[model samples]
Target: MSDKTSEAKVHFRSNAKVHEVDLRIREANVRLCQLCLWRNRKGIGFHIAPSSSSLPVICMVESNSPASAGGLKICDAILAVNNKNISEANYQQATTIIKTALNTKGRVDLLVVEQKFYKELKKNDISMISSSAKILVTPHSMPADFFNFPKHQPRTCDIHVNQDNKTFGFEVVSGDDNIGIYIQEVAPDSAASNAGLRKSDRIIEINGTYIEQDSNMNYQHYLWIAQASVYVDIGDDKSKLEATKLFEFVLYENPLHDNARLNLAILHFNPSHVHALETCAIVGLQMNHPTEAFIDLNQVLHFQPSSAPLLANRSVIQQFLDDNRNQSC
Candidate 1:
């Protein structure tokens, strides 16, 4: 039994050493490949120095993998993974070997290096090795979807306060993580929709500040600006902030249903905003008063006669009103 235990200890120690070496190499390759994927998506690439002291180049990426989608070609040498650098001495076999092992675990890391995209292979600064590194995957295959990826740009529009003094407009931003300000579908009769706000119009900013970049300012900065500018104005609620808190609670109850907060927020800032006028039209339509909706639609048309969507909506409302009038007549 003592002899058997001694043998098992030796084998375990040997395996541990091998795993350490393999892990180091695999880590480097994964970093390189990940960076390559990012560069491809962003239209940029990087350069690396090949030194004898560096880790061995890991398993070259096969073409047609996610890395290849990012333009990594076959047989590209991996140099790093996830920001960890690798050298020729330690990583050449580390990546694939690690990948094979990770297949059992369902995940693996890779670092890859390749000839500069479309450039001739170059010699290492020290050993003059022709660098054949390439990341064999694309951005979509990164372990984490958000790793090293660029975010979508914010969307903004021009609020024509006057012919020459237009101010930038944005949708009311929402959500945690400071990801973006989304103008969920504009309410048909809300101040925003009535003022020509369209669905999917990403609210980028009010006056050029990135309110979406910080969760704390989504309401205070951008929403406040939109309301103040009369683009969205409801009525002066001296305790509007408190009212909003209550509104948040109400919204939380439904969770998925659209809340009245957006419309109310705009109205709170600019009660006379034309968009608010359209909200009245929507209410009229819901109440079976097509004529009332037509009146509200006409009120907005008086402001923006050339708005096509509004015109279309108005035409539909007008038809409804005319049919009702005929019935009444």
Candidate 2:
């Protein structure tokens, strides 16, 4: 029974786009929408209706609250909460996720696919979750060409290394105990292929642990960076001070180094890194750092938009930016 249920979930997920094809409606008739909500004393201001009748729908969106403010409508089906696929979850399970995110993070990012014609999809024997229904942002999966790989451009990607249905078919050529590891080859249509791993992509850090790198000066930069990680890991004020200086030295050497900048940002508050990029951006904006806020916001927008963000609702993002920029001004 469990195996059959899991198989059903995968099928339902795969056929999400079938409605668009069968009905000949617009290709993006059911694109996912992310609603970022900030919790307040008044609550997030939305109610999820019983799904016994259908997929979970927003029964009511309180006026002038995070729900309405975040562009949630009257019937947006709750697809996922905090990137967890809940299409198969019950009402209690769904609400628990929302409550947890609000209680822990004080904010939540919801991926909903509320379509006007959504409720009618059952007539066509279709489900909501699709092949494109991604709750979490992942790495690009483009084929790697030899000439296309470059050293100067480094981007962060999250790969599900250990998964039941996925195979990690990439070869790690060489790695130093201190500098970094490199990807030598990736099999086609494999886990590494889906993760956009290229032949020349260097594996600098794994699960936040720095490893093996090149030049005497470069080696010095990495050494301090590693030491900073240790100091931060030690979780003491003196260690924080040492980490601060080490991270600062790394930034001084390479102004464009994002890890150094992110480390510095986290180190500015807590060295344990409990306050991550989003929190830092929030605090930065609150502290009147518009440049930092805008930079972080734009980076997030660019990375997470996917093809769905470019639809007719591009103004939603643009207006958001304009509004924030005006306030900062």
Best-performing candidate as measured by TM-score? 2
**Tens-digit lDDT track of model 1 for 254-292:** 333223444444334443668887777776666566776
What is the C-alpha local distance difference test score of candidate 2? 0.56
**In candidate 1, what residue range of length 10 has the lowest lDDT sum?**
121-130
Q: Which regions of candidate 1 deviate over 4 angstroms?
A: 1-237, 255-269, 275-295, 306-309, 321-329
Q: With candidate 1 superimposed using the best TM-score fit, by how many Å does residue 326's alpha carbon deviate from the native?
A: 6.8
Q: After superposition, how far is residue 150 of candidate 2 from its true place, in Å?
A: 56
For every model shown, what is its TM-score relative to the native structure?
0.22, 0.29
Best candidate per lDDT, number?
Answer: 2
